[model samples]
Target: MPKAQETVLEIDLKALKHNFQYLKSKLQPSTKFLAVVKAFGYGSDACKIAKYLETLHVDYFAVAYINEGIALRKAGIKTPILVLHPQAVNFKALIENCLEPSLYNAKILKEFITATSIENQKNYPVHIKFNTGLNRLGFWHNDINFINKTLSLTKTITVKSIFSHLAASEDLNEKPFTTNQIKDFKTIAKNFEKTVGYKPMLHICNTSGILNYPEAHLDMVRSGIGLYGFGNSEIENKNLKPIASLKTIISQIHLIEKGESVGYNRAYKSDGLQKTATLPIGHADGIGRQYGNGKGYVIIKGQKAPIVGNVCMDMIMVNITDIDCKEGDEVILFDANTTAEDLAETANTISYEVITAVSQRIKRTFIE
Candidate 1:
């Protein structure tokens, strides 16, 4: 749309707003939304996304690291930010930028407590993460005593929120497992409240949880992929607008004779004479080699073209024998019609990997 310009990832801000409102509409007025904008907003640009969501009155913003929260604060984002996995080494920056850390373990908790005291931080808010099912991070249920002791030690600082990650809220068939997680979290919260005076702004649902388990939408929800579109497929709603579209152009075309080989290792040997189009995108540009040798495809003139041969680091060749596409024609890697999820299925991965793995070297064009 902006004329031929190398490979570009187009970001749609209006679609972002639509997705936010769409997800928010499912919640009650008392429920708050935490827009997870870490990893450059899932590789689409965090500062831009955060600024847009700020206008939409999002309750909070979340990042995986202290630097990301610091960047948002530097960009004039006043909304509360939760640093989900902040390290103790960066406690100074977190305090300086007013970024709340998710104290997942006792060691980090003590370090933060000491840092807060040294900074004379009175009532500085922080989040506590519990490992309900996602054992990758957060404190376990058995660690409740340790957490209680930490809180008692850090009376000067405030525990703003307590949260956990859901293992699978999208799978309706796994509803029993999800329910058990919810039940476990509820039990932990009750015990925590008994020790801490009140529940620390409990939250457990991610994007899918927010939609599928409204009963678990305690005080807040941290939505990542849903904000950028694509909910857990087990759910019914597919209304969220996709905020990003990856596009490229046919740089060259070739006519292959019968039995001719394309790309390295003769990976795509032609059955007969065929036409192929080369695109200026490859594994180096975030289109991994996993999509090579007819595994991946691109849409040219609305027709699907299967990628051929080993994908090069900077380019890929797609079969276009049956299509009438020409050199320089625009090609869509994935869009509203084709769907990134479909592409991910072909590549044996998820939409999250496809979107976030898009290399930073590729140019990005933002559209309002």
Candidate 2:
């Protein structure tokens, strides 16, 4: 909430709560919800988001790294945290913080077992990641025997959950592949339960997975983008409300004659008697250069203003020939009306990059 900050990210906690409710209503009575707070809660604010989710009684919290879980623990988040990708080097810290790690390989499993034994821990919770199809990070189907053998040797460690990632859950065209992944995952879970004598909390559905494949929501659903408001599915996005809006101020205005150019490299030439407004946000604030040269736009007082030239490190120009706007006019990068998908299409990227790449330098204002 400091002054003079040109760009700002406004977060709607109320909208977040609404989205949570929507997802909750869609869940079966027995299913649990695990809020994904990794990547700074997709660049909003992890601590704030986690605090809010805790109030709503979110079943669990998820993070991509051990440090992120440690931060949540320090913030007084008592809910169980599942570390989706924790390394062996941070096992001590993870244990000290009561954070769970996803043991995807025998090496990591052995290392965690040793670390816990050194601490004299009992039944320390951890997750097992299976590489059903994503092949990104997890033990393969053949590694199941190796996992069972290792677990049999250790009594201090307990399997908390076994999960996998869905690569193409949003595309209906890939229903066969998605279904196959679910099938493989279920097979692994059955075999794993037989070996371990019980099934750990099984989870596989991401945001899109939850919408497109509800049956895959076995124990818990890890929701990331959907919680921040974009479900990436046509049907789900319709019900989801955006939680973040980028806003900036018009710092100056210029009236150029015909053939006069603007911005670096003179990328854009004024058509004729054109007026341009310069905004106080640019690439440094996650407004990339790809949005320059008439590729992007901003909303000035609810009126569309087309971007003019190359987006600079700290500023971007918008053509406002017909709009009446002062130097201090408010401009919106994207909001409920202007979807992030539109901005992503304009920038030649995706909505995930647009929302997650927002720089931390910009002030974040939360509204309930």
Lowest summed lDDT across 10 adjacent residues in model 2 is found at: 1-10
lDDT of 2 by residue, 110-224 (tens): 9999999999998999899999788889998778788888888888899989999999999999999999999999999999888768778899999888888988999888898
lDDT of 1 by residue, 51-145 (tens): 99998999999999999999999999999999998988899999999898899887888888999998988889988889888779888888887
State in Å the error of residue 106, model 2. 2.4
lDDT of each: 0.89, 0.89
Instruction: Mark the regions of model 1 whose C-alpha exceeds 4 Å error after superposition.
Output: 1-4, 234-237
Model 2: residues with Cα > 4 Å off, grouped in runs: 1-6
Residue 188 of model 1: what lDDT?
88
Q: How many pairs of residues collide in model 2? A: 0
